[model samples]
Target: MKAKPAKESLTIMNELVLPNDTNPLNNLMGGRLLHMMDIAAGIAAQKHSNRVVVTASVDNVSFKNPIGLGDVVTINAQVTRAFSTSMEVRMDVWGENIPNGTRFKSNEAYYTFVAVDQTGRPIPVPEVIAETEDEKKFYDGALRRRQLRLILAGKMKPDEATELKALFLSEE
Candidate 1:
């Protein structure tokens, strides 16, 4: 049997925020923002897995700032870690100011995706390589996330599991 390909190192997807993307308050709708993140995550997964992949879960998505109309939103994604069949993708959302030529972080999230074969069965994912310090940080965060998932799934007991969940929810 052929071995799986190595995980993707980096991915970035950007689009200009339009009026339709925002809500009545002129802020980007939460669901629309999540949709953008999902698209970015799916692209990153396909690039890494070289096959069809599906989003299994979004761990914690928090919107820190409201994206106003005309602001360009950029979603950056990277593979933090990988297991036998699942991979963790970290996505950061940034807003670019059209007038000031500045960019602000509007939100961030971590999503989990599973690589699947044509039959929709989970498959092994290749190892993720850390090529730089930032990559290392992302990997470390992914490690923590994996541990948290284990705790939630009853695979492990972490003393700070409750604290972790609280922190994650507070961001939202």
Candidate 2:
């Protein structure tokens, strides 16, 4: 498979928190933010894989701050790493106060997606080339994250997770 720079898969989406998008407390609904993040991550995966992609899993989604009505929410996503047929997309969310001209980070999460053919069969995707230090760190940790997720899903054995083992069980 060909290798592609991680930046090639970057996707950004912006949304305004209208009354319809918020809860009764006048804060943006968590589900709405999640939907936005999913859309952004999906676009990134599709751009990187050049194939139809479907969400396989999501992890560590937590909101650090509330987004109020009239705020602009921006979600940024990028491919952190790519496996045989799946990719890990990292999404960062920010809330911008238009009136105050201030923006603050709200949350971040990781999403996994698998490329599929028209027949809905899994298909291989290009490898992600991490050019920046941060990208490289995420790319390196992808294996550990995959192992943990698989273990949690009962798809893999804890003893077989070499990447995770070395991470926490290493003598050094």
Candidate 3:
């Protein structure tokens, strides 16, 4: 399969925090933000594979800042790696105060998506190539992340996580 650059799959989604999507305190709801992140990640995955995709898993989300109503929330996503049938999408969230024109980093998340056929069966996807320094760092870390995910899911043994093992365990 041909390799696609990470930049080609980059996607950004912006939303204005509104009363309907916020809590009584006027802060954006966590679930609503997660929904936006998922949509953005899905778009990045599809852009990379050009196939129907589904969210397989999402890593922990740490909400650092409370986004107030009227703040613009921006979610950025990019395909960091394309595994056999799954792609890892790295997402970042930013809260921008329009009046002050100031933006602050809120949180980051990693989403795994699987490309599927019309029958909803998983299918192979094109590999992702890292072109820039940041992309390369993400690409390099993807293997370890994938291994940890598989191990935690019981789909792979801890011994098979060579990338992760090498990072934490010292040689004799």
Cα-based lDDT for every prediction: 0.80, 0.95, 0.95
1 against 2, candidate with superior TM-score: 2
TM-score of 2: 0.97
Please provide, for model 2 over 48-94, each residue's C-alpha lDDT reduced to its tens digit, 9 standing for 90 to 100: 99999999999979999999999999999999999999999999899
In candidate 2, how many Å is residue 98 off? 1.3
**Model 3 regions more than 4 Å off:** none
Worst 10 residues of 2 by lDDT: 163-172
Residue range 41-62, candidate 1, lDDT tens digits: 8888777777789998787777
Worst 10 residues of 1 by lDDT: 1-10
Report residue 99 deviation for candidate 3 (angstroms). Answer: 0.4
| Predicted candidate 3 versus true structure: per-residue lDDT over 1-172, tens digit per residue | 8999899999999999989999999999999999999999999999999999999989879999989999999999999999999999999899999999899998999999999999999999999989999999999999999888888889999988989889988879
In candidate 3, clashing pairs total 0
The 10 consecutive residues of candidate 3 with the worst lDDT sum are 162-171
Stretches of candidate 1 exceeding 4 Å from the true structure: 1-7, 153-172
